[model samples]
Target: MSIAVAVISSDTEYVTRMMSYMKGSPIYHTWRLQLYTNPERIHQLTELERMELIIVEEHLHSSLLRRLQAGGGQLDELVYTSKRGAIPIIVLAAERRELLEHELYKFQSVSALLHGMQQRYERFRSGHAKKRLVTDDRQQTIAFCSTLEQAGKTVMALHVAALLASKGYRVFYCNLERWNTSDSFLAGRVLQEQAASYSDLLYVVKSRQNASKWLAEHAAAVEEYSFYMLRPFQHEADRRGLTTEDAQRLVAAIAESGLFDHVLVDLPAGLDDWTLPLLQQCHAHYMLLLPQPGWQRKHQLAMSCVERHNAQALEELQHKRLLVLSEPYGNCQPGSSVSDLESLPYVEAWQQGDPVLLGSVHYRAAVERCIQPLLTGEKVV
Candidate 1:
């Protein structure tokens, strides 16, 4: 559900500027914009195209103000040509633009006007609309990390995302390893010789004065999977440049965009201050440890990570699991706290570079079942 806003101004420059700015903006993802040069043309807009707000020029607003003063009803021609209840009309006035119980805004630049409009739109929607909570609008993050590499963390992360995506929930696969694994998972689609991978997304997030517009133009997604993946950064500095806060803001921004229902992060095999923010936010944080000879060492590492961080801060996440990928025949106890799953099978799809090759594995169902509670915040469906 996208919100529509109309801008009716006789000043041709302003109308053209508004259209130009709105076209490739992230606001477009959440808003539909209509531009009208003549107030009389308002009636020509269809009901489906009707606006939630009308940003009118001063001259046009003065005319409408006089009409309203002369005892014009809500259906008057000056009233956005709306046939039903009165639509909120905001005037772009230069003098004493403060509405003081009126609907007028004073703005200098086009960007400022849009920003003011965005703020007002939020207030209006919050007050008058039956809208979902902001928290509900954001995607839930499911983080995958472990103390050692080849703990089957990446495979688990990929399959969980793939399963959710297969179920028609918009899923975004985020690889937060120090070195990007996009080429491994998304070689054909999410990479290039000098691809502007997640670095671009990060750059826009950290620096874009107009982040919504920047993301609309720059964020890259795998269309086939109905998900987005950042291109792998070429230089190590680019990867290291990100602070923990940067990672936090990036994930939050994407989730709030309402583009994905789930964000599955494949964290590298380790824990540090940099990873804690993400780990803390994950609804289901899983530490996958394969039953190799050094299993105890990895388990100790994970426990030490909990100790190193604020255990009290993480008390709420204690229910999160440490999953063991045991074989059909393994030495581990059957009733141990670690949930066991069958050994992973070999997938030849990688020879052809398919991004979702992990979805075909036999053990995906077990992975899905393990995280189903986190996905739904209740019993598995």
Candidate 2:
């Protein structure tokens, strides 16, 4: 999904620099740039070529505002009444102003400028009641699952969540593993006086009540980790009655809450009523495989079961799933059967169960490498 963006600047050199930076960046594939040196050219853009965002120089912004005023219209009207609907216009100023909204310093790094544009665009879309042509506004839900236990699915998921949070994205991490031990690793203050447990959450979901409101009020925010999570279930039995519908509804509530940019779900090993729904609901699936023997056989058996129960779900998983080889150490080689899969470098220190190790510089670099494809919009075939 390429986002159409127009860069309107009278300075030809500035426009060229912006184009060069975007072409070299990881987001090149996701953003389609339309450069306009003459601000008046914006009026000539056809309906099909309408932009989702416009980056205009401060001087040109003033001219555009004057034009709007002459026509008995305001800048807000120009944004909401566009043929393509609700295009966010960002002003590129000479210097940064703390009180200014939707403004970016033009002389900053390309990455910083692009990040500001995205932030403002997101804020505008969320706050305004206007229609948009692009449909990528929904929060992304990514699930990490594996066929074998102790495959570092939870750890990897948390690391990825932390990485996104560090990039200034609001991330929500949900541990759906039956034997969830997230409490041991993520220790933080609960949001409410008495944090509502997963059982309470499931009950709200099952009753078809206001699950989003309940989650917003009860979800625990780990400030140190910079993410939100649900209180882990006290006992494995507490998750025994979680039906497939319940799982789907729970995930829907979280994603639709409009409170997070990404939702990371750490699913239990293997497919069942509970895990299958989550896999189906998630936008991307990271299936972790160990370099040990029988890994392929285990995955094959799991897919066979999924096919037998739900063929549609099986097809969806295949299209969005990324096969990952989980190595025990840095020098460990993946087995012949999984040699072609992407692998995560082993963090031997994490085995010590020190939660602080999860935030170590080395560990984050490993996780970043594993998830680079996701960041670059690369498809897994």
Candidate 3:
């Protein structure tokens, strides 16, 4: 299938020249391209076609981002609204980058820049779907979150939960990603009751009734990994309407029910409004940083906000905030002060739904160092 891509750039001259010569670019035959020098046209594309990749120029969303400034909305709200501003949205900047914010590849010639962009397009198409999901009973709840798209937060959560289950820990990996897709079918398909979904789960949690019966009767498992999995809500608004109270009641009841040893939560990239308060109650948090400054900054900000709001979350984050760094592009400098875990090795098994058992040297070492300690009967911290 041809990858559907939208490329937005503010520089007209660059767009003009590239549009003239792009037919010769490597992806002309293998992919479909839509070009715009303005971001406003995004709404048009969003309504017309489903984009596999969205590449927008830096500063295109500047006005929206202004919401993050001192007089505007706070960072979390800014990201919540903008959908991706928690990380300095990637930009096309020159060599000398500020705090390396708005970092982009610079080129002496337009051809070189286009080539780099094309390379990114190819890499993104090939590896983007590679992913996180969870929290625990042996210990307590764990959160998997990232600052930006394609940062492997889902992959880490799923792997950890699966690995823990492999060792006989009763684990349930839950997805709260908001965007509804049946990706869980890859984990395990269930003979679901037509009404089985977040809507039912929400009612059960909010009413404080019938959860044990519902879970026993309807819960599904990703068979080989031995961890339970839950799909997202049937309707988008159902998830959007989920409140902190709703999530808190749901996760708390699940964790305290003695049905499993741990519960792993797969959170959205920008902490959705619903995820904020539920976050305050988590026992441990993992912020996975891709090899980009934008990603690192968002991961740190997520940690900082959680700490500031919840005293207990802060204390645990101080000791258990997991900083996972992916392989570096050059030399990567992660600035978080919490405990650092090892970098993840990209395993081919991940795309096949078997990453839980991907026993790469670095992955195994990380599970032992970071997860083993919590698999006992104690909350992290």
TM-scores vs. true structure, each candidate: 0.54, 0.62, 0.52
* Candidate 2 global CA lDDT score: 0.71
Give the number of the best model, judged by lDDT.
2
Q: What shift in Å separates residue 45 of candidate 1 from its native position after superposition? A: 52
TM-score of 2: 0.62
lDDT of each: 0.60, 0.71, 0.58
Ranking by lDDT: 2, 1, 3
Best model per TM-score: 2
Clashing pairs in 1: 26-212, 197-231, 198-231
Give one digit per residue, the lDDT tens place, for model 2 in 84-164.
445677888886677278778888888898887877876675455222211256777888998768787887888888777
**Lowest summed-lDDT stretch of 10 residues in model 1?**
126-135
Instruction: Encode model 3's per-residue lDDT on 76-177: one tens digit a residue.
Output: 311221232112133465454452322346434657766655555444322221111223214468887665666666666767877777666678877777
lDDT of 2 at 2: 65
Model 3: how far residue 1 lies from native, Å = 41
RMSD of 1: 16.6
Give the runs in model 1 whose Cα sits over 4 Å from its true position.
Answer: 1-137, 193-195, 320-356, 359-361, 379-381
